[model samples]
Target: MAGHPLKKIQCESIARTSGKQCRAKGYLKKSGHYRCRFHGGASTGAITLEGKLIAYKNLKQFKNYTDEQLLIWIQNKLQKSSSV
Candidate 1:
């Protein structure tokens, strides 16, 4: 209460279990809406082209891997699992 007034704004989302409004403080979004951390207040992922490429690369199990290498890795994994 002694800080920014926005800190007092509660999340607009509801609690799944309690079926009541969430108690967490909300954060302002780009769309001018406030959402809590557990709700829609989290990061919206990478935005810039370079950021998107980095994010996409992070999705791969093996970073910096070529398509053929990934295929080989997958085939090796499949073979090992089938042998077991």
Candidate 2:
């Protein structure tokens, strides 16, 4: 039997102790995750409004847009939703 080829991605987080990126290669377990175990692999979702906005802006399905464009999009959407 043939063995499966391993897949890995470099972690996208910076290390606190080293003041540099962790960059450890790891297998992805879920959508849009790129960090290894020691570099925030297990967690999902952003806690703050700013974090949420940033995460939303980076989603793959979203059109490539400037941060200002995304922020404006979010505000318009939220305003419409809240008023309805």
Candidate 2, position 79, lDDT: 85
Model 1: residues with Cα > 4 Å off, grouped in runs: 1-7, 61-84
Tens-digit lDDT track of model 2 for 1-84: 234325445677778989887757754666666768775547666766688688897788666887787778778977898999
Score candidate 1 by lDDT. Answer: 0.71
Candidate-wise lDDT, in order:
0.71, 0.72
Model 2, 38: alpha-carbon shift in Å? 25
Candidate 1 per-residue lDDT, tens place, 45-72, comes to: 7665456445555665668776566556
Off by over 4 Å in 2: 1-48
> Candidate 1: TM-score?
0.55
Angstrom error of the Cα, residue 28, model 1: value is 2.5
Worst 10 residues of 2 by lDDT: 1-10
- Of candidate 1, the 10-residue stretch with the lowest lDDT total is 48-57
